[model samples]
Target: MSELLQFVFSGITVGAVYALVALGFTIIFNASGVVNFAQGEFVMLGGMITVFAHAAGLPLPLAALIAIVVTAAVGVALNRLAIEPARGAPVVSLIIITIGASIFIRGASQLIFDKQIHSFPAFSGDDPIHVLGATILMQSLWVIGGALAVFAGLWLFFTKTLLGRAVLATSNNRMAAQLVGINTKFVMTLSFALSAAIGAFGGVLVTPITLTAYDVGLALALKGFAAAMLGGMGNPKGALVGGLLLGLLEALTAGYLSSQYKDAAAFVIILAVLFFMPQGLFGRKSTDRV
Candidate 1:
C-alpha cells in the first residue's frame, strides 16, 4: 500500500506539470485551430530565465514573474511574426511552422543558456511531508495546488468573463465571431500569450523537482500532446484529466514494471485515444453534413 501511495504521489506531481503543458496546447488549438508545437519552449524559457535571473541576484518570485511575462511576449511575437502571416495557409503548413519554431527556439536556447542542466531551489524547503506512510516533497504540494488553481482560474475565466466569452466565441466560429465584432485576431494573440504564460508558470513551479535543459522541451511537448489527445483536444477539462491520467500511468509503470517503458506510456495513450476514444473524455463527437 505504501508503495502504491508513493507511486500515486510521484504520478500526481509529474502529472501536474503535464497538465499545465496540456492546457497550453488546448488554448492554442482552440483559438487558432492550429497546434503550437513550440508550447514547451515556453516552459523551458520560464525555468531557464528564472534560474539565470535568480542567479543574477533577483528574488525568485520576481524572476518567475519576469519569465512568465517574457515568455508571453515571445508567444505574442510568434503569433505576429509567423502564425499571422500564414494565417490562411493549410493547417499542415501551420503545424510545420510551429514545429520549425520549436526547433529554432530550442537551438536559440542552447546557444544562449549553454548546454547544462539547471534547477532552482524549491519554493518551500527540501523537506518531505508524510501522508499515509508515503513521503512527498513540499514542492509537490505546490505543483498540485498550482495546477488546481490554474484550472479553477481558467474555468472561471471561460465561464464568467466577457473576454473569456469572446475567446470562446472565436473558438466556436472565427468567422461568426468576427461578424459579431469580436476581435478574433486579438483573441488568437491573447490565447497564445495566455498559453505561454501558463506554460512558463508551470516550468517555474516544477523546475526544482525536475531539473531542466534546453532540449527538455521536445519530450515535454510530446508528452503534453499525448495528454491533450487523451483528454480530448480543445477541451480544458479533458486536458487536465488526460494529463493526470497519463502521469499516473507513467508512475505506476515505472514503479511496478520498468522505468524504461514509462515514457512509452504516452505514446500508447496517444495511439489508444486515436483508435478508440478520439473524442476524449470530455470531448464531444463532431459530424459535418454536406
Candidate 2:
C-alpha cells in the first residue's frame, strides 16, 4: 500500500509538469493553428537559465523571474521572425519550421550554458512528509501548487478578462476577430508569450527535482505533445486530464510492471487513444460549414 501511495504521489508531481506543458501547447494552438514545436525549449530555457543565474549569485526568485521574462521574449520573437513570415505555408513547412526552431534553441542553449546537468535548491527545504504511509517531498508540493495556480489563473483570464475574451475571439475566427476590431496578430503574439512563460515557470518549479540540461527539451516536448493530443488537441480541460492520466499510467507501470518500460507506457496509451478516438477524449467533432 505504501509503495502504491508513493508511486501515486510521484505520478502527481510528474503529471503537474506535463499538464503545464500541455497548457502551453493549448494556448498557442488556440491562437495559431500552428503547433509550436519549440514550446519545449521554453521549459529547457527556464530550468537552464535559472540554474546558471542562481549559480551566478542571484536569488532563486530573481533567477526564475529572469528566466520567465527571457523565455517569453524568445517566444514572441519566434512568432514574429519565423511563424508569422511563413504564414499560409503548408502545414508540413510550418512543422518543419517549428521543429527547426526547437533544434536551433537547443543548440544555442548548449553553447550558452555549459553541457552539465544543474539543479537549484527547492523552494522549500527537501523535507519529506508522510501521507497515508507514503512519504512526499516538499518540492512535489511546490510543483503541484504551481500547476494548480496556473490553471486557476488561466481559467479566470479566459472566462473573466476582456483581453482573454479577445484571444478567444481570435481563436474562434481570426477574420471575425479582425472584423470586430481585435488585433489577431497581437493576440497570437500574446498567446505565444503566455504559453512560453507558463512552460518556463514549470521548468523553474520542477528543476530542483528533475535537474536541467540543454538536451532535455526534446523528450519533454514529445511527452507534452502526447498529453495535449490525449486530452483533445485544443481543449484546455482535455490537456489537464490527459497529462494527469499519462503521468499516473507511467508511474503505475514503473511501480508494478517494469521500470524500463515506463516511457513506453505513455506512447502506447497515446496510440491506443488515437486508434479508438481520433478526435481525442475531449476534442469536439468538427463539421464542414457548407
Note the residue pairs that clash in candidate 1: none
Q: lDDT by residue for model 1 over 1-290, one digit each (tens)?
A: 99999999999999999999999999999998889899889999999999999999999999999999999999999999999999889989999999999999999999998899999999999999998999999999999999999999999999999999999999999999999999888999999999999999999999999999999998999999999999999999999999999999999999999999999999999998899988988889988869
- Evaluated against the true structure, the overall lDDT of model 2 is 0.92
Candidate 2 lDDT, tens digit per residue, 1-290?
99999999999899989999999999999998988788889999999999999999999999999999999999999999999999999999999999999999999999999789899998989889999999999999999999999999999999999999999999999999999999998999999999999999999999998898999998888888889999999999988888888889889999999999999987897798789997788999978888
Q: List TM-score per model, in order.
A: 0.98, 0.98
Model 1, runs deviating above 4 Å: none
In model 1, the Cα lDDT at residue 202 comes to: 92
Q: Each model's RMSD to truth, in Å?
A: 0.8, 0.9
Segments in model 2 whose C-alpha atoms lie over 4 Å from true places: none
Candidate 1 yields a Cα-based lDDT of 0.94
In model 1, the Cα lDDT at residue 257 comes to 93
